[model samples]
Target: MAVPSARLALLLCLMIPATVASSRSLRKSPANASRPTTFFEVDRPLRRSSGRCSTLLLSASFGSTFNKPPATNAYSPPRCLVKAGGRASAISLAVLEWRAACRGAQLDRVFGVWLGGAELLRGSTAAPPPNGIIWSVSKDVTKYASLLAAAGKPTFTVYLGNLVNTTLTGVYHANVTLHLYLRRTPPTKPPPATAPADLVVPVSRALPLDGGLWFPIQSAADVASKSVALPSNAYRAVLELYVSFHQDDELWYKNQPGYQNGPFREVTARVDGVLAGSVCPFPVIYPGGIYPLLWRPIAPIGSFNLPTYDIELTPFLGKLLDGKAHELAFAVTNAVGVWYVGANLHLWLDPGGTATTAGLVSYVAPAAKTTSSKSADPVDTHYHATANRLVSATGWVKSSYGNITTNSTRTFALVYLLTFETLDLTIVADTGVVATDGAGGVMYSAQTHGNFPLGWVYQQNSLTVTHGLEETTVAAGRWSSAPPYRSLRTTQSSLVEDEEGGGKSWGVRQTYRYNATDGCYFRNVTSSNYSVVSDHSNELCVKGAASVGVGAVTAALPTVNLP
Candidate 1:
């Protein structure tokens, strides 16, 4: 049957008029082919020429040619041209790739990539090829594709900084490639115009910490107060916070005795005194260093090169758009040192969507408390003989608009029980959500846990949801160790839908494991999205460790006080 169908199709093609076929072939020729094209290429040098200078101020600047290095200059890619009869949908996708090289040097610098004056990405120079390797990065810039295509010309810049200013001899170069996908046929409708967003306010500087006691810094207070107003038609809001610890800050106490690894401090973001989100930084050493030697990794990269916290401000969009003032605050509880922090608020106005504003009907901020007990100790021990600490936080959030309401409660706990041979660290978090529209409602529950030991960490997460007539549950666990550093992760999920007089169920389970010693990994998956079940497994190998980087560390010194 397949052969006959193929022959029939070929016969139909042969029956076409020669003129028609010739015209089609010409249109499909390489020169006329409508495919993805390189929009622009940019390369910039990092070092000065005349003579080797120990230190040169590498700041954010803008420029055109790549000949001379500028203190700070922005690069603008060529404007994207939409051909005649071409619509936004004609451009299927766009991507930007960045590549750089560094010579004989100590990689201990930080680089910031900016788009339209907003910091889009930042990372340390530690991971680029040691001395002979080329570093390359790629990202999907499709979200900004339409804007770029319509704009006359937009500027993009990369900022480089040597925090330590080590006297290393090396020349650094950066290159950027923009790829755009074009369609052969234009779409029926043109893309919508890009909406303007409020200017991002700088809340605080990346200040240094002395590592003494917990301090209060009102980085951003009343950001959306009467001074900043949201458009009347805005329907949604979001709060994005970028947080990072100085690499040197982490290295300062890396080898210190009695030091527990990872982000130990609790950082919280609040809107109008309502808890938005909280993060306890946990350091995980990448295989290479802070920047992975392998430029591209499987996991998604963050803008801060560190962990980032984001929260949906939809519930508060109403109040903010109400022509009133609102406050945005950040609090670092139990922080012993300084950490970098930045905040941005984004609002979305869709006249076609449900015309509604977000408002916090009720909320209970999370209360965090810490208690510790220790045995009498002098310099005799490494300050780890007998130590115990427990930290916990609990809170609830309730938001409403029109007749819809969402309520959620969250609780987090971290425990550290230490001994001479080992330090037992445990973290647990639980959250439950209920959204109601009149009597009908959806409910969700989740729990996560983490345990850390010498050169190793383990994590577990589970989620359950009840929506309409469907119920779903997902459970996952991951274990990672650095002794011979490796990782093993597993996930099991099930969904059941109640229909008529019976329920239909689907289940899926997957496992992935990687061994750094042998540079090998294994994956297995079993799924039953329908009535039938299926299973598959694969074993693969790679060049080196899955990821390369140093583990996260605290800035606090060993404690000698008892609580």
Candidate 2:
């Protein structure tokens, strides 16, 4: 069974040593087995060292180990270096173990980091130095655990041999950054197809690091559609940030293990507006949904109180689609203080995944787009269900949880909003040529304020996961019901229409922006304070109930239609 929670994967590091036979052999271990790990054992004396803080570029073969499945050989073996660190650093690197390959032509990428500051005082090398040094990969994810930026939360290790007398001791750093690259090589012409069959599989296709829509929230965050077409499949999402505390006027950094609550707070993220999703409260996950990943801050709650730090969301590389476009809507809220402000929210959507020329950036609200140029108009939109029926004219709207963040108490909340830009008109139909609302002769109407693909949240995922004991299995609910909605697909149905037969079902062809409610408020939590600010929280006061004027319906329309 799938590990119910991504939390269990955190322990994968402790089980690494036994599976990883040596620095030369990168092997996959069994999920059910545990083994003893090998500590960093450097036998020789300080052969060479660097004065200024820096990272050691260790080289090893990318050849596959015996345990690896032969099928993986069809793909190029990725090569890079990983310098270990403390608990937090280890877990941080462990969580990001997947993105290790380079884009087309490149075979390696940065996989880990080494943090600087107090972290550099010990472990000396015979090399030059800088006052403060930090090693990191160059991208940012919406969540924490970035390698370069001070705002990220990661774990790292220090080699015992570097202890060198009383000046330094070997232990791990709670936070460590990593720098990675593929071995330098000149580009060559494509190999002949008539080459040995053994060579065909390994070089057949490139890794998915170049650019395309990627599922950042694998199981945690869910989208209405799973697959979309992009230029190439080699795109990747990279997140880089800095974490420092702010007290009085000084900035304090956390380089050791454990959690840093406050006083240390500088963070950021980068992503493709069309290919990613984020959950608030730092460490967020869906357990059984698509993404099982979770974030756990090293610092404890109630630690710091400085106001103005942010996380950067960056998209490493992605493929852009022609004719069709993707939308990334960033829904954010403040965790504490009065509000939250995040700088550097950038998106990169490369039609060819690789940035051959200078990069380009475009900003748009997060909404899915259809091929037709029918963004602002709902010419054909309706909702239908196989089992549910249109009974009364009671007014009800449908929605789902969009963006979320931490509250003043440092806890998180889930907020809801609608999709699309028009007020959907749900017309009640009676068993006849024309139906009528209670107050009308032959007209019925209820206004829907937003677009299709509404969002909602359920509490069942959290309760059992958090409170469940060691052995109990957590339970997840099925996909929740959509609002009183229907999309007509004339090609799929027969002449047997609704009992009232006044309208055919209209499918959601496109979605646009509509009025947002509650402006900004705490979701899921018990807090009663909801504040909106212009300068501090980035909150906009755009509010209006979605409304639409409906015309009289003629008797028995054969096809479903939108207004």
Please, what is the whole-model Cα lDDT of each candidate in the order they appear? 0.36, 0.18
Q: What is the lDDT of residue 122 in candidate 2?
A: 18
lDDT of 2 by residue, 259-332 (tens): 12211121212133332322222211111111111101000111111111222121112233232343323322
Q: Which portions of model 2 show Cα errors greater than 4 Å?
A: 1-332, 337-363, 366-563
Candidate 2: count the clashes.
115
Please provide, for model 1 over 64-121, each residue's C-alpha lDDT reduced to its tens digit, 9 standing for 90 to 100.
2222232334443333334423333445445555555554444434455545434444
Q: Score residue 346 of candidate 1 by CA lDDT.
A: 56
Q: At residue 22, what lDDT does model 1 achieve?
A: 16
Off by over 4 Å in 1: 1-96, 127-130, 139-154, 163-166, 178-228, 251-263, 272-274, 284-305, 324-327, 353-355, 375-404, 407-411, 417-563
Q: Which 10-residue span in candidate 2 carries the lowest summed lDDT?
A: 489-498
What C-alpha root-mean-square deviation, in Å, does candidate 1 show against the real structure?
22.5
Query: Candidate 2 local accuracy as lDDT?
Result: 0.18
Error of 2 at 227 (Å): 34
